[model samples]
Structures are given as structure tokens and as C-alpha cells.
Target: MRKPQVHWDDVEIGGELAGFDIEIKPRRVFLQISGSQDWYPVHHDPAFARKGGHEDIFMNTGFTQAALVRMITDWMGDGGFLRKLYFEMRRQQRPGDTMACRGKVTDRYRKDGEGWVEVDVWAENEREGVTSPGRAWVILPMRESS
Candidate 1:
């Protein structure tokens, strides 16, 4: 009695997720800074960013972290629960850059009676290649057994 919607069993190792791109604009950066209350100058002040060796104000850790979650949740849909998320930034994402969030299911298994899926995810830009690389573990709903 499996539901028609996607479930843990529906995904396979090496399966590709339908990912999305995020445009990093200055206003978006400011909004994130304000929303998170992370008043880091490197994230919002262009001069400070340059002094820190960056070309311009860049997306902060908060935004990067949230972007990863958004990509995974969007792929797994409403029934999934994100259990663990880990990532590192390799390059700065600045205004005018487009972050393409992509992922592949690296593994899937049942653990503690919960269906878990592991994905290798990355955010890339044309200029910086893979600016962020990470992995995430999510608990997706299992199909009911009849």
C-alpha cells in the first residue's frame, strides 16, 4: 500500500535530485544579515570584506547554512526530516553570483526503523566552481507495508 508520492524507497543510490539556483543579490545579503542578526562586517560591508581579502561583501555562514537546508528540503518534500547537515565554504559567494545547488543520493538505508537517505550536496558558481561542499542526512517517509 505505497503512496503515490515519493518516499524513501523511491530514491536510490546515485539518484540525482532536481536542484535549483539562487541568485545572490546585495539586497538578499542585507536581508539575511538583518534576519539572522549576524552583524558581521565581512558579510555586509564591502570595504570590510575587501580588507579581509574578499572582492566584495559575501554571503555569510547563516545564509549558506540555510541555502543547504532549503535545497535538501525542497528535494525531499514535506514529509522528510533533516537529521544532520554539514558543509564548508570553499569560495565566497558575492553579489551577482548564481549559486546552483546540486545533490546526489549517495546512500539509503533503514536505521533504527527509520528510512534514512544520505546526499552529497554542493553549491557551485560558474566562476568559483564548487564554492560549498557538504553532506546531509534526512529521514524520509517509508512506504507503508500492506
Candidate 2:
């Protein structure tokens, strides 16, 4: 199914973007690791994760990064183009945790005739608080020029 496009003129600075929730399960972790070709034991082996001082098997940073990007692009839909994305891992997202991916439009502007929105994004879990915090820039097609 095709998602509706969010035009640049429809975006408002400080507006809230649609958010999503995902459960971080062992199977999910395994799939992400496998897909990303990240074979780190801490991402799938509970015992190894615990040995590394984590409470349980945790999602890998790369997976979290990709997930966050997905969150932004998914919300922006087809008309949006990702220009830049950056994030920092603050906490571990373990299996059995529910993560809420949220973000807001921080700024909007036109550059070189292209409209862009800057977004502040984060992923939070009940137990670990903010697991990842990041920012991104997406170009959205404009309906009209100022």
C-alpha cells in the first residue's frame, strides 16, 4: 500500500509527528542482527549479554539506528527524502521491552528551492527511559513557494 505524502507546506515547526511502538523480542533481535549481518553475541545470547553487564539480550546499536530512521521515513511517507540522520545510544533495549518511537518537527525551511524539515527523534522504553535520541533532516515536497 502507498502511504499518503506529507507536503512541505503541510508541516509545521514544533508539530508532533506520528509515532509508533514496537516490542523488542528475542526473535526481533535475532532477525535484526541477522539482517544487518551483525553477529555480536550480546544481541542474541542472553548469557553473553549478562556477562557484558546487560540485564538481558539487547538490540544492537545498528539495528536501533536503522529502526529510528525507519520511524522518521515512515512518518514522512513517500514525498519525504531523508537528507541527514544522527543518533546516540543512551540505554540498552532488551528483549521483552516495548519501545515507543517518537519525534517532532523542530524546524522547517527552504534550501536551494527544496523544502526541508528538521526533526528531533527518540526511542523510549518504560524501564530504560530514553534508549536512543537523534535528529534528522527530511525534504518534503512543497505545494507552493513563499
Candidate 3:
């Protein structure tokens, strides 16, 4: 029983989720690398990334996914559960890029005595339009919903 910032009854198909912005500094990238345990040199080694023809050391796939999850979960609050999430990295997220995490409600429905919401999510960088694009399904608590 988690307390909800948003109730099932209050959601709309086209509603927007709260967005988060972060500057992709080396420290942040290091933290992401550490937290995810993804030690790919490309994530932390600029030389390796440059050797691979990338501009600079960049955020990894797992970090990108986590950003999307953070955006959805922050919007849904502790009352909700992230049932499913899917995303793709279209471009590299490098240091000095500002990552803008955004989401929009695509659908809302109830099934099996539970309330669910479908949201389209993405991370847009100032340098590149969208580095990651995805979707997520969340289970939110009902408020006088039937």
C-alpha cells in the first residue's frame, strides 16, 4: 500500500508526466557506471570512445534506461509500480549534454481488478534531439476508482 501522488481516477490519456533535467558531467557518468556495474571502457574512457569514433565517453544503455525509469516513477510516485519499460538509444549521451527526461501518458485502463497506465517516454539532449525513446506500463493505485 504505497501513497499515490496520482490516482488512477485522475489520469488522462494525453496527460504529461513531470520531467527531469540533468547535465551529463563526468561525475554523473561515473556514478551511473558504478551503480549499474557496467564497466565498458567506452562509458568511462574517452580515449576508447574516441578510438571507436565516438565524440567522447558517453552514458551507457543501462544508465539511459534508468533515466527513463526515474522519470516515470517520479511522476507516478511511490504508490505506483513500473510493470514494464522499453527504450532505445538513438544517439550517444556524452558529457556536457543536458539530458531532458520526458514522458506523456498514451493510454490508461483497468484490468484484472487493477489500474494501469501506458506512457511514452524519452530522453532528449540539448546536443541531439532524442538520445533515447521508449514506453512504460505502470500500475497505479485507485482512488475511489472501480
Best by lDDT: 3
lDDT of 3: 0.89
In Å, residue 39's CA in model 3 sits off its true spot by 1.1
In model 2, pairs of residues that clash are none
Runs in model 1 with CA error above 4 Å? 1-5
Superposing every Cα of model 2 onto the true structure, what RMSD results? Answer: 1.6
- Candidate 3 least-lDDT 10 residues: 1-10
All candidates: TM-score: 0.90, 0.90, 0.91
Error of 1 at 5 (Å): 4.4
lDDT of each: 0.87, 0.86, 0.89
- Give the distance in Å from residue 91's predicted Cα in candidate 2 to where it truly belongs: 0.5
What is the clash tally of candidate 3?
0
The true-versus-predicted C-alpha distance at residue 78 of model 1, in Å, is: 2.2
TM-score of 1: 0.90
Candidate 1 lDDT score at position 2: 36
- Cα lDDT tens digits, model 3, 16-88, are 9889998998789879978899999999988998999998988988888888888887888988999999899
Better model by TM-score: candidate 2 vs candidate 3: 3
lDDT of 1 at 53: 85
Distance from true location, Cα of 10 in model 1, Å: 0.8
